[model samples]
Structure formats: C-alpha cells, structure tokens
Target: MPNLLSRGLFNLFFGSKRKAFEKLPGPTPGVLGTLGDFIGPNPWDVCARYGREYGGVTLIWMGPSPGLVLNDPAVIEEILLTRRLEFEKGNIGTQIRPTVGDTVFIANQGEDWSAKIKVEPMAQPWAAAWLAALVGPLQAAINESVDALLKEPSIDLTPTLRRLTFDGFAVAAIGEKTPDSVFEDFMLLAKGADARLQAKLPLRFVSFPEGFEAAKERFYGYFTERVRRARAALNPSAVDLMSWTLREMPTVSDAWLGHILGTLFYGGVFSTSTTLVGAFHQLQKYPAAEERLAAEAATLAGAPLTFEWLRGAPWSEAVAYEVLRILPAVRIFLRTPAADTELAGVKLPAGSTLMVSNQHLHRDPSHWKDPETFEPSRWLNGGTARDPAGSGYFFPFGRGPRECVGAPFALLFLQTALATIAARVKVHVDSTEPFEEGFFFGVVLPKGVTGRLIARPSQAASLPGSVHPSAAVKTA
Candidate 1:
C-alpha cells in the first residue's frame, strides 16, 4: 500500500517532468524519494556530498516533490535576492507552522507577511538602541553562566551557553528573565518542531515525545501572557521588543503577537547559543585567535560593554563572523517558487523546493582561500577574504527581504559575549577529539563536547560586578 502511494505521488509530481531533472546529479531516490536521505542521522552530510559531487545545482526528490540543492553563489543570489518575490516559504513554512504558528518567521509572501516584516522588532532602525539597552541584562546573564562554569571546571559548554542565551533573550525580548522550567518547556516544543521537520511529512503523522502538547501549551501560554502584559502597559517610549512590536502594530491580535514573540525566542535562543558554543570551541582550537581576541578585550578593559563598543571590536567581530562561516547554526534554508521559474537553464515547476546549503557555500574552495582552515583573519580588513557585506558567498543570517530579523541583535550579543568571556577566562576544550556535528532541535551543535575554563588573572580586576573577581582568579 505504501509503495503504491509512493509511486502515485511520484507520478503526480513528475510523470512527464522527470526528464527535466535527468541531467542533474543527486543520490538515487528511494520508494519515498530523497525523503529518506533527509531523515537520516546526518542530512547535512548528504547536502555537502550532493554539492561536492553534483556541481552547483543538484536535483533532489522529496517524496514526489522535486527540489533543488543550490550551491552556486550566483544562483543563490538570483533566487534569494534578485527574484525573491517569486519565491515563498511553501512546504518548509508549513513544516515550521506547527511550532511557530503563523508568525513572520515562516509566513508566506503575502499581505500578512508584508505587515509582519514591516513591524519586525529587531529589524527596526531603533533596534540598535533597544539591544544596546540590553547590555547590562545580557552581560549579567552571561556572567551567571560563566560563574557556574567556573565552579564546574569540566562541563558541556552547550547547555551552559543555552541557559545564558535563553536568559539573555528573555531579558532583551520579553523584558525579564524566564524561569528554568519555562526554558525547559521551550526546548521541549523546539525539539518537537525539529522532529516534525526531519519527518518530512505532515505534522499530523509525526509523533512527538510525551509532554509535547503540555510543553507547547506552556510555551505559548507564557508568550501569550507576555503579549497581554505588553498591551496593558503599551507605551510609545518603551524600548523592549514586545512593547516596540505592539507600538508599531497596535491592531495585531494577541495570538499573533504571542507567536511572533515565541518564534523570536526560539530562533534567537537556540541558534545564538549554538553559535557561541562553536565560537568558544574554535577559540580553543586556535589559540592565536584567542590571544588576539583577549588582547582586543584588554584594550577595552573597564570600558562599558555598550553596543557601540562591542560592534567596534574588529577582531572579536571577525572571529564571530569566522565561527559563523565555518559552523553556521542554520545549515539549510528552504524556499519554494511562487511561480514556475527557470534556474541555471533548468526549468522548475511552481511550488518546488529550493534548498541552499550554507555548509557547502561557506567552505566552497572556489570562493574561499584555505576554506577548511579555521582562519579568523580572513574576515579582517586588508585581508585576502572577500567582504561578506558585498560578497554573496557569506550569508549565515541568510539574505533578501526575509532574512532573519534578529540578525543585528544576534551579532551584537555574540560579539559582546565573545569579548566578555575572552577577557576573563581562557577556554580549554577538554576533548581533543575532532568535533562531531549533529542537529540539536534543527540547530547545528557539537555532540558530547566538554570544555574547561581557566581564569585569566590579568583581566580579573577589570571584570564587571556580575562576574565574580575572586572566582575568575581562583577557577584555574
């Protein structure tokens, strides 16, 4: 019966169009097409292999649905930037809808999406000041996490970073720190969403772990309450994300606001935390880079860790960019054509999925020098690396009109966290083994990676109040 259904789907999507994708290269599809490949242990590896062996544009079959893996920078630019309106979130958006609801993160290109983007909190010009105001709260959160790390010398940095990011995001976006229970609930919901994505099937068919529904209710309820409170205290001068969002779009529904806040929290917390883990891991591996960052941090000793200060630290910003380039949190971006289109001489049907592999593009030899090497200097000015701003090759935050709205805030948070930690302690990854990358609720993270922190005595005196001076000096 399943085989018959698979065959039926195959014929329905590609009865006569199979010939169109015949020239493109990809792994042979199974009875369920390339759906099996994506649900496997390492779908990212499959994407990398497809790009390496199949050239710039590779055809993939998602069951009956035909998709393209786009590795070419030029092709990506055309799809993501030039003809962006021609594409919408499509099936991928549907996959995420169960988790984030109909928020801007996964909303299709339409009037609602347009309105959501216009009022997206982090993308606003005043977003810098809002994020700047969060430095104290963010730093306090980071300090608490670092303090805990100091007590436990050997620990998995992933969880520590996760807690830090969640707390920081809460303070910045929700206007207060969330309880640990709420964080756990959010993780539960996020994990369920990731499971749905991997299933590559409709949400109805995907089975989640026990407590999933309760977690979802709790997570959404928390955000819903936040929206209500923001509405009650609506102020034109309020600078927090929820307040700002409400001020911009007063007529928006409470559920819509809740979903928007939930999506931002989910998107910001997990991805940012994973990126921080990767940054710390990379810093440990490349001591020279660590030294440079520490020195840069030292220069700003006693200086307030303001938004401007964090953004102005060139080497820290460069290292953050390098880590993002090498280990992008979001490995794959999914887009679907709103109308039938032609890409690289191949015709694509309307609604066909377009997958862009950041992992492949970030390391593509043609676009990067020493692509495999962990070289932070590549992002430095007057260096050999192309400027990511002008260069289409680097897009960890994605590109086009629908790019991650929290990009500026995320970068500032990353730069500040990296600089703060580097100044106070020297990171040492306990595991000498090469990192084994895996997906943690759709975000890329290292598995079983443990690290220790040694106090840097030189900068202890200059450390902030939140960061314990005695603990920093005694942690080693």
Candidate 2:
C-alpha cells in the first residue's frame, strides 16, 4: 500500500509535463521526501531554513506529493487573499475531520462553509458584546487562576497558564468553570487530534490515537450535557458562546452544538495559553516593558476589565500582538489548490498542497526590522513593526475571509487576562530553559517556564471590582 500510494503521488505531482513545479527551488528530498521534516519535532525551524535558503515560494516534496512553502508576503497575499477561492483548506479539512467533524466551521467548505459562517456565533459582529458581558466571570476566572499560581513560591508557567486560559474559556464559552478532570480529557483529545494531523502518510490515514476515541467520547459527553442544560435553561439574557450559538441556531442538534462549543474551546485555549506564556517570558526578558505594562495596568484600578477598557490599554494590546508575531501558536497553515492555479508565477496542479509558514512570514527580514527581536513597541503607532491587519507580512490569526473567527474573543481574552495578571502579580523567570520551544502537532508548546509569581501588595486591593480568589465561583 505504501509503494502504491508513493507511485500515485509521484505520478500526480511529478509528471513529465509538470515543468513549472519541477523548476521551483527547494532542498532535495530525502528518502521520506521531506515528510520527516514536517512530522519531526522542529518543523517550524525547518520551514525557516527553507524560507531563508529558497526565497519566498519554495517547493518541497511530502512523500511523492509536491508541497509549496509560501514564505513571501506577496505570494502569501496572492494565495490567501487575491486568489483565495483557488486555494482552499482541502488537505487540512480532511486532516482535522476525524477530530472536529465536517460540520464544524473550520473543516466545512463551499456552500456549507458560507452557510455556517452566517450562524457562527464567533463570526457575528455581536460577539464582542457577548464577550463583554462575561467580563465579570472572565475576570473572576483570571483572579482564581492567579491565586492558584501564587499558592506556590515557584512553579511551571505552562500548566498554570493552561489552567488559567481553560478556566477563562469555560466561563466565556459555557458560563461556568470546568473540572480539572474534564480539562485533562480535553487536552488528551486535542493532543490526539494534533497527532493525527501531523502523523506520517500511512499513519495519517489512521483515524485516532490509542485512547483518543475514549477521551473524545468523555469530552463530548461532558459538553453534550452542558449543551442540554443550556438549552433547558434557555437564558436569552446569558452572554456566553454556547448561549449565543443556541440563540442563533436554535434548531441545531445538541451533538452539533456540542461539537461547535468543543471546536471553539479546542481552538481558543492552548493558543491563548501559549501566547500568554510568551508574553510573560518576553516581559521578563524586557524589564522596561514589564514596568510599562504594570504602570498601564495600574491605571485600570477601580475600573472593570471590560472590552472597552481593555481595548483602551494600548501597551497590553501591543504586547499581545508582539507575542503573537514572535511566537505564533499554529506555526504552519495547510491549503490545497482547488483547481489548476498559478501562485507566485508558478503553476500548481489541482489538489497540490501548500504550506504557509507563519513563523517565516512573521520574522521575514524584508518586512520587519530586526525581525528576531521581541519588540512590543513595533506594534505602536510610530513603531517599526507593520500593522498585521494592513500588512500581508503578519497573520498570526491568518488573513482573508477565512481568517480565524475567534480572533476577537482571543484578543480580548489575551488583553484582559494579561492586564489582569499584570495588575495582580509579577512573573519572574528564574531560568532561560523555558524560553526554548517545541512544536507539538501544529501548536508550539514552550518548555515549561519555571517562574515565581510575586504578589503585588496593593495592586489587587486597588482594583475596585476585583473578585477575591475564595469568592470566585467554582461551579455554574
């Protein structure tokens, strides 16, 4: 079967008439045809090597299949914006279908995707309002998580931030806190899904990891019950993702609703956690930046952590944007030509895979000054960093019509949580080891930062509407 598959891919991508694809510059493929580079621990590093050596658009062989790494912003704009319809999430949709199902917005395409977009709660303009309404719950979640962090003199920031983001996501998504056991199951399910997406070809054909199905079932069951309970209560005044989804798609099945909720949680949590971790790590590295953030957060004393308020905190917003630019959670994005198409002056046959490296594009020397440096100030009005929204060079959340629907929520959450944390504690990284990163499935996980959370003596007390850790509700 392996030989047959290899022969099929070879014929499909390397036909005699495929002069255009054959002429594209890239490293010579190994026996595994560069598949190892993608499935290995440091695909992002390999992608950087490709961009640095091969220029903007480079061709790579994944098994016998031809995959193009789009490193140039012009080509990126062409594929992701100008000719978006020509390139869809074909291969990626197939890869994540087993985990998120085809009905979920990310995996759906064409007319179905168009229809789903309309009902997607996160895609709606009112999403900000829904998120704003949860400021109290979200702030409480952050406070509780920080309190847990303060319990120990020194600790690993990764798991702590993970719990922090998960709790915040629970409150914003489902109107309550989630149990640790459920979080464990969801992590297993997420990791398993990522494994399937990043697995080698024949293994990629395999559906789920060893215990994936069980973990998914358990995770789904918990969410299914939550969906049913939300339906039963049917609070029109409620302002969580689940509530919005229910109100928008009133007739959708409980299972379908559960999948939507699960998909958002899966997409939102880990990425936010890693971004926060990066923010803290960067802040610790640049003491002046930390001091500025602390000063800005200080002004928020006696004010609610509302969306409007968080939006006004420019430094916090800049820090979040900078961290996203420097350490994108999903390092690479996969797409495929829907039909024979030309990108960057190179013709690609239908179904050919395209890999866009966010890491490469984010750090491209041509578009950024000292691209390697972690400078949050670049995002400020007069700073050197280009606006990601306007510049094709930066797209941590992606670009075009299919850009991450959850971006607003993610940004709001990041700003609120970062400011809230800055207001409550000072993060001191005792070791440089945590700054090291590893690629997992597609998400970048930091090598757990060992840090001490020093409590700000009067910071919490100064906040007028602060929720005490003990007073924060643990249940719905």
Best by lDDT: 1
The TM-scores of all predictions, comma-separated, are: 0.85, 0.86
Model 2, residue 28: distance off in Å is 3.5
State the local distance difference test value for candidate 1: 0.76
Tens digits of lDDT, candidate 1, 366-413: 878999878988877754255553246778888877778888788878
Instruction: Give a tens-digit lDDT track for model 2, residues 1-476.
Output: 13556545555655553355766887655545666666645877778788999987888776666779888777777777777767777655666666666654454456767888877777777776787787767887888787767767567877788888988898887888888888888777777667766666565466665777787887878888899999998999888888887887789888877877777777778788888888888888888999899999877664667767775788998898888988888777778888887776677778887888778878888878899888888888955244654257778888877788888788888888888888887887766444778755457888868876766656546544443433332220
TM match of model 2 to true structure: 0.86
Model 2 residue 128 distance off true place after TM-score fit, in angstroms: 2.4
